[model samples]
Target chain A: MSGSGPGPTAVPTARRGRRTVDLPDLVARARAGEARAVARLISLVEDASPAVREVAAALAPHTVRARVIGLTGAPGVGKSTTTTALVRAYRQAGQRVGVLAVDPSSPFSGGALLGDRVRMQDHAGDAGVYIRSMASRGHLGGLAWATPQALRVLDAAGCDVVLVETVGVGQSELEIASLADTTLVLLAPGMGDGIQAAKAGILEVADVLVVNKADRDGADQTVRDLRAMLTLGERRDGAWRPPVCRTVATRGGGEGVAALVEAIDEHRRWLDSSGERARRRVERAAREIEAIALAGLRERMGEVRGSVALGALAEAVVAGETDPFRAADVLLAQL
Target chain B: MSGSGPGPTAVPTARRGRRTVDLPDLVARARAGEARAVARLISLVEDASPAVREVAAALAPHTVRARVIGLTGAPGVGKSTTTTALVRAYRQAGQRVGVLAVDPSSPFSGGALLGDRVRMQDHAGDAGVYIRSMASRGHLGGLAWATPQALRVLDAAGCDVVLVETVGVGQSELEIASLADTTLVLLAPGMGDGIQAAKAGILEVADVLVVNKADRDGADQTVRDLRAMLTLGERRDGAWRPPVCRTVATRGGGEGVAALVEAIDEHRRWLDSSGERARRRVERAAREIEAIALAGLRERMGEVRGSVALGALAEAVVAGETDPFRAADVLLAQL
Candidate 1:
């Protein structure tokens, strides 16, 4: 069986003087609740390491299909606080939880913001919780390619729930929503957030609407505005309506967090009973497969990019000897 | 000879009772400076019409490789006003200009904002000027696919210079900069925009910087801040350094507009003298061709997305029967 599995040549060999990575051993350790092992697996995924394919293959059978919840909001709407509160609530409930804080706006990777680090310190000593931050790293489709793999690492490591928190802005918000089983769109009062959300078209992706800092003035008005806006868009009679839950995330004792947790559970139940959970998982897996395939094709294209063949084709297009579409066809043929 | 070109079968046939596009005739008229013909050609590109491949072939030989100038800044930073002022300056110099205002944030297409319409009225009747607004239509890689094709339409329509203006937000700013021969990063007073620009990494794409609303308070401070930031980034010994230009775009008589035009021309000269123009165009064409080819592959992937084969593969992955990378390989084989 070992010989029939990924052969020695297929696996990435260790460099001189470096310790060989036994992926199977790492996966076993991670499954046994070793935080260091889990972190190492995620690091490999984040780095797009050559051994990632083997790592994925090793981790496959152990994955429990952890429930994914996405939380997104504009900066300073208390996303970190809300996420911290959610993590604490899940830990109190005796559940293993994971958090992936994705910062699409930041170009650097692995550096969590000072506030995120401070808030995450609450779970520092708790083996039941894991938190990591991933940055864009300036590659085309970087987040789309890496985020799901990291989720898989945490999922296989026995986290029952994983929360993906992202700074909701153009493109990235929708991307994160697509990766989650449940999505929370957060807003705050006095931010003109209701109209802004409508304009951003973010309302369409919300599985749960969160008004954080709900103790602030005009919180009721914000909720009303969101409800009114939600009514404006027609939905199928039996479809799940995203519930609005108000939370003062900064309050002690995880104020309003239990209600948020209940809302998540209700959405989960709806998903299961509606047969949407199975359907969504299939869809998500399909997307993952497609993304990986496309990334492979893109890598091949990159190889052809500055080659003499492509240079000649591009020069022909620039010289008006051929059109870009035809040039592209010639190049694609090479690929 | 006509048969030797893109065959009649390749041309998109006119549906019953619908007028034929006559792409060849449209291209001819557009080359002869007919604005309606130019608009028709661009519409075909924007719609991603089936005839686009043939249209590109028709327009290939006529393209003059128009100079592309990209203008981007945050909203309320006078992008439209500055664009208007630049168009006036170019018109005064007897150079035909084209403007493509791309709003990636807007979900609707072809609907220019009221502010844009009012500002564009400055040259409403000028046949030498062409202005169009392109909005994101929510497709994957929408702007990346369409904007370059539209630029081709305008370049082939005999514009001396084509200006692409986009809101300087996440991702779109970098996209527009990549498409331009010269990129202008605009800022205004009292927005703390210098730090914002630095944080966004927009400064690295700027070939020239503009301080619009230069008459406002803190304009000098803004300029100083930008200069200080620019100095911190190391450049090659002989690399072209971006110049900071001050412009009150709304002022009458096109305040500082001539200097801005001169800066653009100077940059053009440097692009030519440094062999950067040839290098940049080749790189841009390579990217454009790559985008078109990837889009074609994406279409094929879309076809397989819901197929029984893909469904089985996705189900297997979800069931832990296989990893996504292996499933993706199977799907790629089918493609």
Candidate 2:
């Protein structure tokens, strides 16, 4: 497995007979900014293919370049519109953009069919843009396991910026935080979204608070409400205060969208100056590593779950023969 | 750890010096309908106290009776108000009811600050009702770990029906599905909540679709939208079709509320008659056991994370000496 020694590829006969994947070739193609190769690597991550570990290893050297931004909010918050506008803004600045929409819907589903993704087809003609949607269909470890690897694919494929868009309402929101350098929380005016945002606990993670659909009647009031709420919420000393910005994303308002990009840049600058970038990256890697470790253990546990040893232990726990903790220890020991 | 061998109580010399908790005594009090004892036990679970394993062991014999119903919706959709109304209806039938409000806002924050809990104080004088709020502040396993243990405490405390209320906007909603015998997805008209519900990916988990605040002008529209969405979403053959119901919960409308209860009872009967009850329970237990196992491993991983062994492995993986898979294998082997 060590590249320093005889690489995993050195034993060509053993590798070819087993998996038959030219991992090195794929990695080279991805590094050369081939969209198809990047997509293939992400597909492998999504599918949990056997060669994914090798892919991760191959892509490690080129993983840290792209700026990853997370966009999240409740339904109808114009996440997709904002995402599209941001893409255009970055493209105007001559940056290659990648969009990874993490669907918070059912696992049996796929793609960014959310109508917002449909609007993003404006970028489809540009080879410099790539869009992918990932669903947590059968993923037990959820976004914590899959998103990082996908981001790595885009990063190594020479994307200048990658936007991670997810519905900002669950455990996945936190996972997005780990993968992103900046997180934008979008909300629409009216419908009591300001209160909803606070209640849903997304306020704490917002690096930039965006009230999309700024032309709505209550947009100013919502912005005010958010500012007041942030004041009441605790803030760390010397921490960057999340700016409240309004944007009518559908209208392609350039200044508002550019301000958002500026906010992201400032946050990135702060992250760098405060030494939080390396800290966040290390934490993200640690989480990704732990998620992989847990996923592996779960696979082992699945095989042992209904085995005689586990069933007996479960029965013993139920029948007052043993405690669940002790039984759990026994199960882990077996693994 | 096996009760059949020598119970944890028999090792008083070993236990008394470390912790003086009397697990059997507390369990007995909880069974005798002592709210204080129940609260104490739940506090232990929330605190993740070591004695919780013993508490779980003692209470295991009494946990199967309660019918747990999970009620969730957006923040201002009157979840708390509807919950209070339902609790009153259940209390009218001479049944003991317990409420566990899973607060996504903050983990250190507890109790019913959601205003609906304040309304539920209408039943405060009634000894048959128990209300507790749980905060998911720092729990990494989120609803997967703390909730089940808390539900068990309420179940063993002689409640006939336990209402597990959570703000239904995230991964906790799915966790609630596994815990509840029936799930009610509450919506209010006028806020595009129906679309939000669908977008939140919670539509698939709804056993009962409730449009609260039906007096609002868009109440009918919301109900219609939900029905249309349900028509389009996939449904398992022979599975219960969620019925959309209207209710003005704060006014305590009897007939509408009664119909909702009837739908719940009908669903409960279907669960029993169709054996879905057993199947869901099996799946739920599997998830819980797996969560517990992962939690244990996380504790082990925490110890190993920055330690010499894990640090060395991480260095190897980052420096391209080894892939993360093999590095993870090394870490797990040490655990």
Candidate 3:
């Protein structure tokens, strides 16, 4: 399907093989505070091949154990501001951090205007904190596919905490739910229940609801409305209540948002404890297999497109000379 | 990998001698105008089993003989209104018609609210008319995995023309481009540049730009703006020139949009002349193979989910001792 991303039509022509890029060594260097290696590795994974994907999958087993947190919200709701503060807090706790700010639009046009991309001021020159941004054009599942792979890369790179950020744009934001261990849904004061949010199905799945820019007017009212809606139904997973935390991220007023972070960790354990994790994994595995199969089936369709009997069969159906059921039966028997 | 859909999760436990479903017979019944048979046949093909999907691969070649025209745009732009008008015209021209409405909403809700569905009063009870709605919950591709298979059912059912009505929500509408011979982007006048329509990727893929509700004021201006945009780019397929049509579908004014339909037929001939169809069919075959592989991989992922190797690998990655490339390799190898 030709969705937002380019199709697999761009044939590399080069014989498919494992990437020459030394991911493990590059990751090791990043762990030793080599920023360039980490940058190269990110690009390497972005443009990876099936063989490279295989290699990444193989090595992911031994990567660092880090609680990967995904922070997402509508654009301009202070997600970057919130993430910057959180990074500082984690660093203060003596944890090396990796931040992958995923913004898809910038990548498409940046081959010429790429200079403007270095505008992220938070960690441009920080050795201790590694940060990268990706475009959406080549991203299949947006951050979902990329984040999981990138998380393992950072894990091997010695980052104790990997923070992923997504610019939530309408229905596409749901991609975050699949990627994060603890997905925080960031909301601003007084935006209320947007007509767009209701249509997109975002309000129903927030793991940790955060009312950021809390210092603004009407913060309490917004929180109140969200709480009222959340209270209308019993929580899906009772162990983790999505507590609404109010945070003034810029001035670090609610720097203790760590408590909310802790709650998410608690929720993760609860999910595993309740067998939901296993259920989800099984479900995902099945879906992945089915999706890939359908994709593959579509690819291999050419080999059988020209069976002489096939055309006559369809024409017979169109001519009402045969019923569809019998036609399918005949076709299956031949196949 | 798997979101919410009844995909094949657990590996099939039955003997592999034959499929659980009688596919060809079911397809034949669908061709004979049985809605239930059509639904069941689609379900049989949308599976996580390589064998069942092998049926789809075997069956796809015998299908896809009809002229596929896609209709889509932002919600409440009166796509259903335009669709009914187009259907009536197609019928008057003596074409056997089948309408596949791709609705992302749950089928249960849609069926219950069928009264609210746009009523094609003229063709409501016509035996030649077949209508079905598809839910968006299943499959990795927003287009149902069974769609190509279902297309076969309709093609074998004596359908001379097939109209694909898309939900236009998420990226499902974009997939319509690849599936259809002609794609009509229905835009209502006066709602200039809605976030949905402004998405450049979709705009670029449209084969025909349609300004619906053309009777409303400022329709001319909207048409001017749309026409201006159409001339700005080199089109996706070099030989085809996308055209724009304005329609007041409710009154059926300016309803003669069949010129684009003829253009699409000519384009098919062009593809054959340039040997593009050969390339397209080749890629299609590859997709079928890919889909089958994906399903097989997912079904086998269970064998590795709870293994000590999985746990040990995850723990190692958690400890920052491995890279993702190696982890991916290990996981796939285990599968």
Candidate 4:
């Protein structure tokens, strides 16, 4: 409860025991090769405190420099393999990378699939590389409540490329679409009819279409089907061709993954061309700012949202006694 | 430009457009034998409008008279066919029936495949029936924005039973899950691998597992797989055993259809005996009340929310310069 809402307005004036962190200094420390400092900054961001807002506000300019990418698709589509390749690709290019592999495997279920986190353990020893695992956590937007901030932590930590691996095919993937600079939708062959269902909303935000394990049988049919679907489903703006790439991520067969990277670069150009992407970027910024203020607004007025008279008004609204307009006004006036 | 955000002040006087709808009224109207009213009203709910809220707000006490059932699966699972058969079964029973078929197929698409609406035209002229085609107008929680409101329309119109046919695998199914009392997840045996992917999130919402087109190969395997998956998955506190039923909907070989209906009846008794269904009804009531408040909030803030500043603030919020609470404060402060 202490950090639930915006920090206490009065107590906020005094800093002791608040545990609200100084992210800018930590960010600088992390940039100076201190992983612990980067971790501390992420902890602060997850802290739901107004002071954290102040830190985020101060760090926003520094954080926006990194390129954020979201990788998503069906399970068994080699997203982990693709992600590992991505990390290697970026690291080979001398860029620091951070990876968040978010899947929903129950912690209590201990077996073959018990710990998916191990798929990412290859990054354990690599310098200039950081990887973490997250759960479904029921965050409808795909990431955790603290995910965007965690991304900001990486952003602040000076990771050149931050990759987000989504929980798959839900609203959360859509949420990740909004969070990343480019979204790569990974689809394997043999989904046949399921792709029609997948082409609809947030999943379509992908800047690149990755067909992993393409060396397998039915690759051509899958590619043809995907191409037909993509063709029939004209890009709303033709902003990007949504190029399909064939990759055998396991053997690293398709080493020229740089083409997909180039597509993202071209998308940035299109963003500049139509100015829509720039507008989108600007919109993202505003959301981040507003997120700061509204994080604890209602909680700041605790019990106000649950008063007796207010409760009566809510019932009246329900009972058709008075309009909801009167109800909200009465509540706002009380506040 | 037209409909956005909570406006300043509060709810305007319930002038003209307000009281036209809601879930209960639509439900009542549908029960009263108003087909056109039912169609239009379903749309109103699908839109998630205040009109729906108003109608729902004025809702009277409703008995647990109707069996609200949902049919869902990957596309091509013959949900539409199964639904048609299910309706035919109800018609055979001489019961008043309602079907809300969700058609995510863009009305604009001119393909050889009969529009889902046309495919479902079988129930069009029945005196004892009402049929509606619902479109997922973009943002997909599923019940079309108008579904709940339309459901009310059907209820008031007096359909003894209501069936919602939803998209198999889209986020739109979530809409049906939230609205339906009993959800029947339809699957074709061939899409076995796809089933594993779906089992992650949408599967657990099923009250009944339907493998339509039982004449098709892999029918037995699909049933067995689903049963194994169901058992491997955890059970809810009052969760009904989602009896997996096999039916060849296209062939009129749906002999097992009656048992599916009986399972629903059995589940309803469980609802009463275990008190879980009552708990759900109470929860739905709470949700209905919340929806009312949420819908009326925007109409109340007529001016400020409609202001030019919104366009500007949207940009600013995206820019990360202005905090959303401060934005709300400024907007509200105008009142």
Every candidate's TM-score, chain A alone: 0.89, 0.87, 0.71, 0.76
Which stretches in model 3 have alpha-carbon errors above 4 Å?
A1-247, A252-335, B1-65, B76-78, B104-120, B139-141, B167-170, B191-212, B218-238, B243-246, B252-309, B319-323
Candidate 4 residues B181-253, lDDT tens each? 7788887878743366355466677777887777788888878877887788777776677788888777753
Candidate 1 lDDT, B1-335, residue by residue in tens: 11232222111112223256898888888788776677777777776678889887887776447899999999899999999899888878888888888888886555356655764455656667778777755353656777877888887778899999998877888888878999999999987478988988989999999999999999999999999999999999779899999999999966888899999999999999999988887777777777788888878888997899999998998899999899989988887
Interface CA RMSD of each prediction in angstroms: 2.0, 3.8, 9.6, 6.2
Off by over 4 Å in 2: A1-19, A23-48, A54-291, A298-327, B1-19, B112-120, B138-140, B192-196, B224-238, B252-255, B318-320
Q: Write one digit per residue (lDDT tens) for candidate 3, span A1-335.
A: 11223222111112223446665676567556565655555565555444445546544445436666778788768787788777767766778787777765454421222222322344444455666665544424344444555666676677788887777775445666655556788888766443335455666557788888888898888788778776764766455666778788777434546776666677778777777555443333333323332333333333344555555554554444543334444544443
lDDT of 3 by residue, B1-335 (tens): 11232332111112223346666676667667565565455455443334444455445446456777788887777778777777767766778777777766553312222422444334555555555555444543335344555566667666788888875766766667666766888788766353346554566667777777878887888777777766776557656666677777777433545654555566667767877655543333333333333434444555566666666555444444554334444665554
| Model 2 agreement with the true structure over A92-186: per-residue lDDT tens digits | 78998888888767573334365534743465457667777777654555888788888888888888999999887667777788779899988
For candidate 4, write residues A1-335 as lDDT tens digits. 11232222110111125454555676678667566666555545444555555555555445356677888776678777788777777777889887766664422111123223444345544557666555434222224345666676676666888888874665656767777777888877775233653555533676777777778788777777767777876666556676777788878424546666677677667666777666656555444433433333334334454456656664564344654434544555654
Cα lDDT of all candidates, in order? 0.81, 0.76, 0.58, 0.60
CAPRI rating of model 3: incorrect
What residue pairs are clashing in model 1?
none
Off by over 4 Å in 1: A1-19, A63-276, B1-18, B68-127, B131-133, B136-156, B163-269
Please report the candidate that would top lDDT against the real structure.
1
User: How are the candidates ranked when ordered by DockQ, highest leading?
Assistant: 1, 2, 3, 4
Writing each residue's lDDT as its tens digit, candidate 1 over A2-47 gives: 1232222111112223256888899888788777677777778776
True contacts kept of each: 0.73, 0.22, 0.13, 0.14
Give me the runs in candidate 4 sitting further than 4 Å from their true place.
A1-35, A43-51, A57-284, A290-335, B1-32, B48-50, B58-64, B104-121, B138-141, B172-174, B193-203, B216-239, B287-335
Candidate 4 chain B weakest lDDT stretch, 10 residues: B7-16
- TM-score of every prediction relative to native: 0.75, 0.62, 0.63, 0.57
Please report how far candidate 3 places residue B273 from its true position, in Å: 6.9
